[model samples]
Target: MQTAAAVTQKKLKRNVSLAFFAAAVVFSLWYINFSFSEFIGGIPIFMNFLFTDFLPPKASDLPTYFGPVLDTLAYGVVATVLASVIGLVFGFLMARQTTPHPVIRTVMRGFISLLRNIPFLVWASILVVIFGVGSMPGIFSLILFGSGFLARVYAEAIEEIDSHATEALDAMGAGYLQKIKHAIIPQFVPGYISWTLFMFELSIRASAILGLVGAGGIGSQIKLTMDLFQYNRTSTVICILIVMILVIEFMTKRIRERLI
Candidate 1:
């Protein structure tokens, strides 16, 4: 029967896909220099840092570290807000809905890719040198990162929207701004909000690391404690960061569920 033949073909295709995937996995491991000894060698250093350098967290310096935590939070919030706003405008420009120019879309997409390709640390490092050790570099780096990501997602969301609705709006002679404000925004509000929260969650983690170059967060606190050989305080800071991350994760999950 034709059904039997089709089923056999599907099975054959599946087997071929599995073979390719299995080969790729083997090739990846071989190419990457993966070794058990490499992992074993790194374990002890981590153990030493954990057991000797970071045990019995000291709570004495809580007051001193408080300011830096607030600074980091402020940096993340400011950067996220700025990124979302800029992304809104740029996303409109980047979306082919308004422009419909292939060249512009390609350029915008390429720029977004470029922004995401560089590691944030590398961008933060360069920014620190140009701006000099502070929250400004951290915030700016996040803005660049967030704007690029949001612009692409926003463009895709716009493009995927119902054409009939857009057509109806066009028949009414609605201006581009009005059409976008009335039609596009309402349709995409849920997705936009979800992504914005997602970005904030990422910002929370990035904010912590951004302080490494003196961007002013718990990272700076960790650096300071390490410099002073205060492993106890460092442990406390680490614990606090872990809790903050968990709390943010929980909050984001709840918000996302509610939005849905």
Candidate 2:
């Protein structure tokens, strides 16, 4: 009877706490600087941009975009390839189970964390200075981001695998390479492909934005048109880009589904 009473008291306390927290959130939302009024005030501006600025898109710019489109696709392909290779190496090295060395794993983890957190823009800026402004900087930045992301994913995937499989490989007098090739790689193939696909998707967006820094791609054309107040051309360019991205995504999805 005493224990039952205690449980009821704890439940009541938790309910009261949650109720207060919910009330506080409701009050904050109603009175905060980020209230719906802020969005309401911007509706007119959004309407003007959508109705006045984006209508009658200049479809004439489509022809001129072929080269830039190809360049962007090429950039994504190259960056994804490089990132997959680098990420695999780093991921394997960083995996605690794979490394089995405290210091080395710590260092690798730190490096991955650093690369993951730093924005691609910052890397692009640094690369621009060193590589002297071109597609290369964009490619390098994509490589950095993609590699970091894939490395983390790969490492986590490795950590989730069956320890027995690894032990079996080890019992056969297998070295690290042999254990990975026989035990790890086969199981990792699907996850590796998935990560590569995701990185390719990310690289596509990164490649598009690289043109903002003169990294050379379709983004440069959009930037130039927007700077000149050629809104129609910019709108048309975005439309084309959307269609291209959708097509690529569709094709990739089909392939991945088949493969998986």
Candidate 3:
């Protein structure tokens, strides 16, 4: 009887805690001036803006946008390629059995962590200051972010693999390179490719935003159009970006399925 009473009390306490949390969220929304009534009231204004400013999507500007679109694609591709290569090397070093030294592993891991934790926008903004507002800054930002991300993924993938092949090679007096070539490479290649493909998708999206900071791409075009109140052109650019992403995603998805 005593235990039953305690259980009831615990459930009531939990329910009360959840009720307070819900109330707090409601209060926060009110404090921030977030109201469904306001949104409903603004619908007519939103529709006016949409029809007056965003319709017919600046189709004539599509030709001029080609260069920036290509630049975005190039940034994503080059950064992903470079980052994958660098990340693969570092990832091997991060693995327990593969690292040349424990100290080196620790340092390499710390560097990868730093790269991944820092936002690409922050990287691009800083690089733009140094590189003077070009695709170079955008590419470098993607490279840094992609390398860190790929290295972490690759390292984890490496750690989870069956060690029997590598162990046999080691027992047969195989050198590190030989073991990597004969055993580790075969097993890790699929995951490496899959991760790299995923990173390419991420890099494309990230590179688009890099242009907002003057690191050239379609984002720069969008920013320019918005500054001039050309939301129609901005909408067109976004449409192209959406199509590009969809195509890339489709291609990468097929490739990943095949590889994995």
Candidate 4:
């Protein structure tokens, strides 16, 4: 089915693409002043620093982190719940199949885009400035970012639902609310739960670091320890964070497996 000229053209295009990719790699390396020798030499230095500075974490400081850890979990839980509710509403508005109007959908899409484009840490920093350093700012930041992300994904999930049920509802002259409740909700619930769980995991990580910006949570402990040149305590906080994340991830995975 292929002509000789067509095959030749395809080969030429492939070669050109490869050449451009190679050139881009070379340009990036030069632009960054990349040095293979320095990169190789840095590994041992990094290892030494890690072992000397971060090893043998201070176990005694664990008791002091209880309140901060709880605050971090609270921030993540509240943010994720609020974000999921907001996302559900906006998701329906943004999806083509469920949208009330094209203009509304476009507006919502733009708003969500704006929220999602701004980094979560940046949101925390800005909010902290407005509200002053506290859990409220960190929680609000996570909610804003999570809502944007979930709204986009939820819209996609809604759009991907089987059309047969919706079509039947339409044929029966069902109202928008009726159609959504009877058709969309059933299909969307599983994916919504899964995505929300993923968002919660991300929120936990984000909340942990929000303290670096004076937003509040266990991350503030990290910042304080680092500021005091207490690497041992810093390592302890980091380990706790790691353990918390791992436990959350494991729980989420199990929940998804059972529910989704």
Candidate 5:
């Protein structure tokens, strides 16, 4: 279906794109000072360490981790609940169809952007510095980051809803709250639940990592064990963490399937 010139042009474009991609990869390797020999040399050393130091996890430490595991779950649950509420409010404000004023929407959008752009660990670290290392900082960090992320996604979901219903409400002289209550809420609930569950999973992982900075969770135990060079204990904690994450993931998937 193509002329010879068109086919040649297509091949030229493909070749150019490949050339650029290869150049970029080469530039990146050079920029990072990557060494093929060093990378090859490290493989056996890494395997040796994995087998000699980190193998055969100390399952004896499992019972001791129960409380910390509970704390991690609590942090995630609390943060997800709080963030969902906050995100709902902001999402309504950010949605162009639902916003009361353009200026308010702009301000809320900027605020949400600020919150979402910062890494969760960075947020945890900052809060730990301000509030003194504890669970509060980690929880607050999850809340902040989750709120931003959920608000953005919620706003997008709201925006994607069929506009005809709201437009009809507008034509019927419906109040803003009436339209939101009758139309937006009904449409948004499923997405809200799904996104909230996803956020909870992320919050759990973040909370665990936050503990490394003394924000308080199972990760604190990990840091302690690693500090003591108790690699076996560290391995045990990691195994527990892996199990917890897998369980949460399974539950979340099941819940999403049922609810959404």
Candidate 6:
């Protein structure tokens, strides 16, 4: 049904977009001082450091890391739950259909965007200065980061819901609260759960390094070990982090598969 001119124009637009994407990649590499030759030259040295210094992970240190690692897991779980609750409220405000006013929606969108743009490390640093070096800063950092991301995801999921359901409720003389309770909440549950699980997985990884900024977690252990040239202990910590991440990823994938 499409005309030849339309097809040609579409192809031209696609090519232009690809060109711009390639240009952006090149620019980013240059801006970051990425060098293929340097990377190749450093491969041997990197391998030597990895094998000689970090090899034979100190299994004995496993017991030492248990407490901090548990702290990291707790941070991830608590942050994920807090963020989901906050994001759920903000998400309704962000969604086009659910938002009460255009101005409020726009403002909420901008605030969420700002939260997403700022790195968790930056948040941790600022909060650490305010809260004074503890798990509180790290927890708040994950909450801020996860809430912003999940809000956007939740907004999109809300937007994609079948409009007819809301319309039918409206026709039935349903109040806004009733319509949302019956229609939106039911439809958004699966997507919200999936996104929440994904965010929890990410928070686990983030919490691991949060301690380096004095926010408290396994990252402090990593930093301390590295500073003392105790690479073997650091390697053990790294292994635990890798295993934790892998397990979370696997569990989330299976859960999502079942839910979705």
Off by over 4 Å in 6: 1-38
Give the Cα error of residue 122 in candidate 2, in Å: 2.5
Alpha-carbon deviation at 17 in model 1, angstroms: 11
Model 5, backbone clash pairs (residues 3+ apart or across chains), number: 0
Worst 10 contiguous positions by lDDT, candidate 2? 29-38
Put down candidate 3 lDDT per residue, 104-128, tens digits, no spaces: 9999999999999999999999998
Q: Mind giving the per-residue lDDT tens digits that candidate 5 earns over 1-260?
A: 99999999999999999999999999999999999999999999999988889888987767899999999998889999999999999999999999999999999999999999998899988999899988899899999999999999999999999898888889999998999999888888888888999999998787668878999998898898999999888899889888999999999999989987
Q: What is residue 77's positional error in candidate 6, in angstroms? A: 1.1
TM-score for candidate 1 = 0.81
Worst 10 residues of 3 by lDDT: 203-212
- Comparing 2 with 4 on lDDT, the higher-scoring candidate is 4
Q: What is the Å distance of residue 119 in model 2 from its true position?
A: 1.7
- Candidates in descending TM-score order: 4, 5, 3, 6, 2, 1
Strongest candidate by lDDT: 4
Question: Model 6, range 135-219, lDDT digits (tens) per residue?
Answer: 8999999999889999999999999999999999999899988988998999999999899999999898897678789788888
- lDDT (tens digit, per residue) of candidate 2 on 1-260: 56988999999999999999999998887786565776998999988987798777887657888998898889989989999999998898888778757798889999999998998888888888899878889899989988999999999888777788889988889898888888988888878887788888777777657778877777777788889998888888788778878887887788789887
Assess each prediction's global lDDT (C-alpha) against the native: 0.82, 0.84, 0.89, 0.93, 0.92, 0.92
- Global CA lDDT computed for model 3: 0.89
Ten residues in sequence with the least summed lDDT for candidate 5? 203-212
List the candidate 4 regions with Cα displacement exceeding 4 Å: none
lDDT value, residue 74 of candidate 5: 88
Q: What clash pairs does model 1 have? A: none
For candidate 1, give the lDDT of residue 99.
Answer: 52
RMSD per candidate (Å) reads 3.6, 3.2, 2.3, 1.8, 1.9, 3.7
Backbone clashes in candidate 2 total 0
TM-score of each: 0.81, 0.83, 0.90, 0.92, 0.92, 0.86
